[model samples]
Target: MCGRNATAVYRFGRPGRVELTSAALTMAMRGFAGGGETQITAVNKDYRYTVFDRTSRTGFGEGGRHDTAMSSGLLIQRAGRTVAAKACSRDATVSAKAQAIIKPGPYVPH
Candidate 1:
């Protein structure tokens, strides 16, 4: 009936649409840093990311804080662009999860 092309959303090898854009990362950072209304400070000239250690947090919704695991990732931005990122996990998983949604800019390292 309808045609759906997942390829448009995916790029085999080296990712073409996954990494976060500079603006997206900046907005997120600003929101988290200044309550979504305050001006954000410049930490660096190049895009930098702070990786978070993901391992699941306790339980949720009446499950009681017994034991649960969760994975997490931190967003980093540079002068409006996200360049590099680091996480407690491997690049493969990160690359897969993001699924080429944003697409790294040209001249970016593979």
Candidate 2:
């Protein structure tokens, strides 16, 4: 995950992991930071995994404070139905450059 459009691999369980190309990861992160929803699909064996993030905003401009929350997770689907779902840890932190990378755009789906 170093140079020019590399892939990032995330392991959630033994023999369970998802590999996301740089472009996909960037889009997902941008969408997540922008308080929007984004998804990336990956296939392993017979399972279809959808890694997604959903963000919600509240109290915007209220007393000069805005509250934003995001929930991220992976859903495993087989035969077009969800089989398992796992939520990412709540303690995760976004990088310091998060604000610089955000760009407004239409909803992204993959």
Candidate 3:
């Protein structure tokens, strides 16, 4: 159950705290773009999380909510599909989560 905040592997995405278990991987994204944590379970590998344009203490609860105008559920670039990861000489089951909000800003794409 021991965990600490650290930079993401190869800086592939936002930095966060990592907590590992025999059956799952937990990461709580921190800093300006951080809102909640993403948990990747071994059984499904589905990352249940909430992150967005603005910080909110209310996290993604029970996977029974919808994306608001300001926030969206987690986005994942699963392992074996990330090209930047291979170029960086890192090979592992890496998962990335990006906040998908519809707004014109650095977080959103044109």
Candidate 4:
């Protein structure tokens, strides 16, 4: 996993066998939040995410023009509902890191 300040590769295994380090996760969170204040709870999580590819071209030649693209990562939820994100969406790698954290499992606030 690549964090804001560090990178690591985790190999999952049997329960209690593989553990996610706090430092690595923190780095990733920092990258996602971009040094912005983040709030984590059983309800939701918030952060600042800037899109790398914010501009996109639409249509064709003459009329073709560049426009801002609007996109966001998948919605994460603990139960049967969707948890609202404060500021979500960034580059592909950052989105992947965010997804990894919200994957099915226990939530440990960093």
Candidate 5:
């Protein structure tokens, strides 16, 4: 769970790592819950860290259910292209603090 002081860490390559504080994570969560595909970015020196999420519902569903698919991950970009990317696990669980920030809508598949 990411709180006001918490941070998310991502490692790429041999020793490259990026740490995103709660502020960026919160923005990413909000972007994810808002709708459509979103990308929230944070920069440190010359590296850009981008957090992205995409949500869509299957045509077979009528209301909020398991028919919706949600995907979230992080990307490391240098120059203007991606250098590394990682996806959240399918069984990932969120803490209450993170959940409050996400505020899943009725159309969200929980």
Candidate 6:
């Protein structure tokens, strides 16, 4: 697989170093508020994953050993829903573990 990240159709889970648009984020929140569930799949060749969301249910891995990470195992509040993902890579792929949420400050980047 190439060292650079690849972009493909947005799928739940297996969330790679992918970014979500604010509009999409809003929709996700709305779904949660409306008692709807959303799913996302991540595809990076190295590791792919699938994620499911629900209003009544907590973010990914709410059962045990909660790891708040943004990539696949990320858990953060967006729009209004608490999102979490599970991460996994190919045996040949290596990945860095990171926190899902980065507290925002007063300053916004341009």
Model 4 misplaced regions, further than 4 Å: 1-62, 70-74, 88-110
- Candidate 2 C-alpha error for residue 102, in Å: 17
For model 3 the local lDDT of residue 43 reads 15
lDDT of every model, 2 decimals: 0.32, 0.52, 0.28, 0.31, 0.50, 0.29
State the lDDT of candidate 1 residue by residue for 31-91, as single tens digits.
Answer: 2221111111113346544333233335455645345454444445666666555443642
Best by TM-score: 2
Q: What TM-score does prediction 5 earn?
A: 0.48
Task: Kindly give the number of clashing pairs for every candidate.
Answer: 10, 0, 0, 2, 0, 17
- How big is the positional error of residue 75 in model 6, measured in Å on the Cα after superposition? 9.8
TM-score of 1: 0.24
**Candidate 1: residue 59 Cα off by (Å):** 2.7
Model 1 is weakest, by summed lDDT over 10 consecutive residues, at 33-42
TM agreement with the true structure for every prediction: 0.24, 0.51, 0.22, 0.25, 0.48, 0.20
lDDT of 2: 0.52
The local distance difference test score of model 1 is 0.32
Which prediction has more favorable lDDT, 3 or 4? 4
Candidate 1 error regions (>4 Å):
1-44, 60-65, 79-110
Candidate 6, residue 67: how far the Cα is off, in Å: 26
Candidate 3: 10-residue stretch with minimal lDDT: 101-110
Residue 17 CA displacement from its true place in model 3, Å? 31
**Model 3 RMSD in angstroms:** 15.3
